[model samples]
Target: MSIQEKRNSDFFLRPRFSIDLKENPEELLERITTYLKSDACIYRSNVADKHVFIDIPVRKSHFWSPQLHFEIVKVDKNSSTLKGLFGPKPQVWTLFMFVHFVVATLFLGVGVFAYVQYRLGESLVFPIAILVALPLIWLLLYFLGSIGKETGKNQMKELHNLLITIIEQ
Candidate 1:
């Protein structure tokens, strides 16, 4: 199995990859459905329209494992474009996005307050400390996300391997 080029940013928790297959969209989807049935780790496979969604429950971990989604679009009579995305459950992903938004909004507010205080020649110590703390919290969140990514790395590989195995067959 050769390494597949992942199309995700370093800071992103969701990873995606795409490739062209020399099969019609229907044939590709059929092959995928057949493979998912035989895969022990995967449960709850759903295919709708041209997309496939699979649930991968990890062992001994309370957190939800990342889901795998595939979209197959026919390019011609004998070719199709396959795009895949691997991501955490919606609740987990939304929580992370909410945290980021809150941190950024609070940081901006604190920075504005600090600037205003400085212009008035007032004490800048407390506001400056808050300004620093917000970003530290943001950085901490980033590192935590990175750690989460690392924790899920192996599972991600498993999902990718399944895709490759099915496609190659």
Candidate 2:
């Protein structure tokens, strides 16, 4: 299946609208908002495939910034497919938490091993091992994080391009 199809299958409530705009950004936004207000939940507006995903929570608060909560995937002249991808914030947070948990587990295990080594009257192998492993663990985590970000960006870009194609037709 296509990426768009995959996304559609995943979303419980995906309301997508495509518009060809002659008006300015402000007017286009106003028009899109009017159409979106009816749903009052999850809606996507794609103007020539430059997509803006909006999420309206149950409790409305003007103090909160929608941009922070919602993902706005845009496509410009210099934009790559990488720019269009957006990973869900919750999933990203969860991934980071899992990484931290794994790192903590490794540290705890190493500490216990070191304690046992000390009880057996060994040299400073535990400390040396930890010093070497810590940096390696950090490097792995950094690489994973970068990979996730790049994947999300690429997905968003592909989605934007697909949306644009759909809108054009």
Candidate 3:
């Protein structure tokens, strides 16, 4: 199987891969199920109602890890296209987005308030300090997200291997 993967630095951007397989969708799905069940690591796997979701923790009990999704679309009677996406868990992604939003809103609100106070000749030191700190916090969060991605890098590779092995077979 030939797989092409795309990646980006943004935390929200997930790595996606596309591959064409000689087998039909059902056969591909069967191979994936077999692989997941035979793997030693316990994965939260679900396949029903034409939906597939797999959660393989990078480490057992770890708070964060990437999720893998697969969809098989039949292109012909003997060929199918497999699409794969790898990203962090939904809750973790949502929480990160919420935190970033809060930081940005606070920064803007305080910035405007600080500007008004400055126009009225009030102290700028504390407001400026806070305004400066918010961006720094945001940057720190970006770095932290990068760290989280790095921490899960190995698991990402494992998931990729699992997918490729099943598809190639």
Ranking of all predicted structures according to lDDT, beginning with the best and ending with the worst:
1, 3, 2
lDDT of 1 by residue, 24-133 (tens): 88887888887777755355678888998876654533364677888988899888888889887677889989999998999899899999999999999999999889
The model with the greatest lDDT is 1
Q: Flag regions of model 1 displaced more than 4 Å.
A: 1-12, 37-41, 58-61
Misplaced by over 4 Å in model 2 are 1-89, 123-127, 154-169
lDDT of 2 by residue, 13-100 (tens): 1123223333344443444445555564243433333344543232431221121122233243322121222344445556667887
Cα-based lDDT for every prediction:
0.78, 0.45, 0.76
Candidate 3: segments with Cα more than 4 A from true spot: 1-13, 34-41, 48-51, 57-59, 73-78
Per-residue lDDT tens digits of candidate 3, residues 1-169? 5555444444454666667677777877887787767756377777764456778753552555787887777889888777777777889889889999999999999999999999999999988999999999999988887787777777778777766666676
| RMSD per model, one decimal | 2.9, 11.2, 3.2
lDDT for 162 (candidate 3): 66
Candidate 2 root-mean-square deviation in Å: 11.2
* Reference-based TM-score, model 1: 0.82
Candidate closest to the true structure, highest TM-score = 1
